[model samples]
Target: MATVTRTTRADAPERSRTEHTGGGLRGAVAAEWGKLWTTRTPYVCMAVGVGLTAVFAFYYGSIARINDEPVQAVGKAPIASVILLQFIVVVLAMTTVTSEYATGSIRTSLQWVPVRHRVQLAKAAVTGAVSFVGGVLLGVLGMAVAWVPFRGHASFETGEAVVQLLSIGTYLALVAVLSVGVAFVCRSAVGALASLFFLLAGLPFVLLGPGSEVLRKINDALPQSAGDHFMTGDGDPYPSLVGLLIVLSWAVAAHLIGLAVLRRRDA
Candidate 1:
C-alpha cells in the first residue's frame, strides 16, 4: 500500500508539471501582448507612422495639380504612405529585443522560460502579429483620410488601392518579425540596432538606388527591394512573393542561429 501510494503521488506531480507548462505558454503570450501595448515602442511607432503617412498624403494631395495627370496623382499617395511608414515600423522592430537586452531583462525572460527557444518563438509571433495589425490600420486609415482631398483627381476605392494599404501592414509585420530575429542573433542592444538600421535603410540605398547594375539586381531580389512591390503596382521584376520569401528565409535562419546561441550561451 505504501509503495503504490508513493507512485501515485509522483504521477500526480508529473501531471501537474505538464499542465503548468501549458499554462505558462498562455501566460507568455499574454505577457507579450501586455508588453507591446504598454511599452512606448508600439504606441510611438503607430502614431508616427500613421501621422506621417497622413501628412505625406495631404502634402501630395495639396500639390496634385503639379502633376500633369492630377487623377493619377492619387495613385502615388498610397505608395508614398507605405514607404514613409516603414521607417517607423523598423524602429519598433529593433526595440523588440534590443530594449530587453539593453535592460538585461532578457536574462529574466530566459530564467522564467528556461526553454529559451520557446520564449523567443513566442516573442517573434507576438511581434509579427502586433506590427501587422498596427501597420495595416495606420496605412489604410491615413490613405483614406487623404483620399478626401484627392476626390477631384481619382477614385480611391479601387481594389488595387486597397491592396496598397494592406501591403503596408504586411510589410510592417514582416519587418518587425525580422527585427526580433535580429535582436536574438545579435544579443546586444546597440550593435543589433546599428545593424538593423543599416539593413533597413542604408543597405538598400547602396544596393538598389546608387550602386552598379549588379548591385541593383542583388538588392532588388532582397527584402528591401521586394518591399517596393507593396508600394508599386508594377508587374514584379521577379515576383513580389520572392521578396517576401527572402525576408522570411532571412528571419528563419537568424532565429535558428539565435536559438542555438541561446541554448549554449549563459543568459
Candidate 2:
C-alpha cells in the first residue's frame, strides 16, 4: 500500500500563506481591484458625484445664460462643478483604505499582500485609475450639460476642451493618490476626511483674507489651488506646469509619509 499523508491545520495556514505570497504585486493589485468594486460605497459615491455634477452644471449654466454673460470658454465651464464635487472623490478614495480597517479586513489584506508598501501602492494605483476615469467622465458630462444651457454663448475650441478634460483627469488622479496616502496615515475615515477637507478646502479660504504675502504664497501652493490653476489653464502666481508639479510633489510626499507610518505600525 502506498503511504498516505494527512494535512493538519498548521500546514494549511503555511500553504495558504505561500499561495498568497506567490503572486506579488500583481496579486496585490488584483485583490485591491476586486475589493474596490465588490462594495456599494464606490457605486453610491460615483452616482452621487455624477448627480451633483449635473445639478451644479445646470444651475450655473442656466444662470450664465439668463444673465447673458459674455461668451465663456467651453473648457472652463465645468471647473466650478468639478471643484465642488471633489470631496466625493476624496471620500471614495478614503473609504477604500479606511473601510478595510473599520471592518478588520485590513489584517486579511496584509496577510495576503505581506509587504505593506505593496498594499499601499496597490490601493493608490487602483484608486487613482478609478478617479482619473471618473474625472474624465465627469468633465465630459458637465460640459455636455452646461453646453445645452449655454447654447450659442459658449466658445468651443476642441484643443482647449480636450486639454481641460485631461487635466481634470490628471488632477483628480493625483488627489485620489493623496487621499489614499492620508487614509493610510490616519487609518480612519473621519480623520482622513477632516484632514483632507482642511487641506483642500478650508485652509485656502482661511488664508485668502488680506494678510501677509507669506500666507498668500502658501495659498497659491496648496493642492486645490494648484489643481485649479492647472485645470483652468490660469497663469498668475505660477504657470500651469508649475501647478501640476506642485500637486505631484504633494502626492509623492503624502505617499512616502504614509508608507513610513505603515511600515512602523501594526495592522
Candidate 3:
C-alpha cells in the first residue's frame, strides 16, 4: 500500500510538468499580447503613423486630381504612407522586447517562462501581428481617403492594388520581426533602432550614391533597395521573389543570432 501511494505521488508531479510544458508557449503568447496593449506607446505610435499617412494621402491625392492623374494617385497613395509608417513600426517592434529589458522585467519574465526561445517567439509574433494589422489598416484608409480627392473618378488596377497592399502589410510585419530580433541581440532600444535605421534607410543611399558601378550593383541588392520594389508599380529590374528573399534573409539572420544569444546568455 505504501509503494502504491509513492508511485501515485511521483506520477502526479510528472503529469503536472507535462501539462505545463505542453501549454507553455501558448501562455507566453497570451502574455505578450497583454503586455503589448497595456502601454500607451503602441497607441500613440499608431495614431501618429495613421495621421501622417492621411495627411500625405490627401496632399498627393489633391495633386493627382488636379492633374487628372487618377492611376498615379490611386497606386501611390498607400505606398507613400508605408514609407513613413515603417519608422513607427520599427519603434513599436523594438519596444516589445526592449521595454522589458529596460525595466529589468525580462529577468522576471525569464524566470516565469524558463524557455527563452518561446518568450522571444511570443514577442516576435505579437509585434508582427500588430504591425501587420496597423500597416494594412493605414494603407487601406489612406487609399479610401485619397479616393475622396479623386471624387469617384480615380481608377485602380484592382488586382495589382490588392497585391501591393498585401505585400506592404507583410513587409511591415517582417520589418517588425526583424526589429524585435535586433532588440534582443542589442538589448538596448537606442542601439537596436539606430542600427536598423542604418540598415533600412541610410545604407541604401550611401550604396546608391555616386561611386563605382560595382557599388551601384551592390546597392540594388540591399534589403531596402530591393524591398522598395515590392509595392512600387512596375519596371523594377529585380524580380519580386529576389526582393522578398533579400529582406527575409535579413530578418531570419537577426532572429537566428538573437536566439543564439538568448540561449548562451543569462536573462
Evaluated with TM-score, which candidate comes out highest? 2
TM-scores of the candidates in the order shown: 0.83, 0.89, 0.87
Give the winner by lDDT: 2
lDDT of 2: 0.89
Backbone clash pairs for candidate 2 read none
For candidate 2, the TM-score is 0.89
Superposed model 1: Cα runs more than 4 Å off = 1-24, 73-76, 209-211
**lDDT (Cα atoms) of all candidates against the true structure:** 0.70, 0.89, 0.82
Cα lDDT tens digits for candidate 2, 1-267? 999999989999999988767388888889889988999978998899889988888887888889998998765667887777689889989898899889999999999788889999999999899989998898888888888888777788888888988999999999999999999999999999999999999999899886879998999999999999999888998999999999999999999999999899958
RMSD of each: 3.4, 4.6, 3.0
Tens digits of per-residue lDDT for model 1 on 1-267? 355535567698898888787446777777667777788777777677767877887876666744635476345675666655666766676676778778888788777777777787778778878778876677666667666766577565578666766676677777777777777778776777787668767788777666588887777666666777635544667666666676677677767876777778746
Q: Candidates sorted by lDDT, descending order?
A: 2, 3, 1
Error of 3 at 230 (Å): 1.5
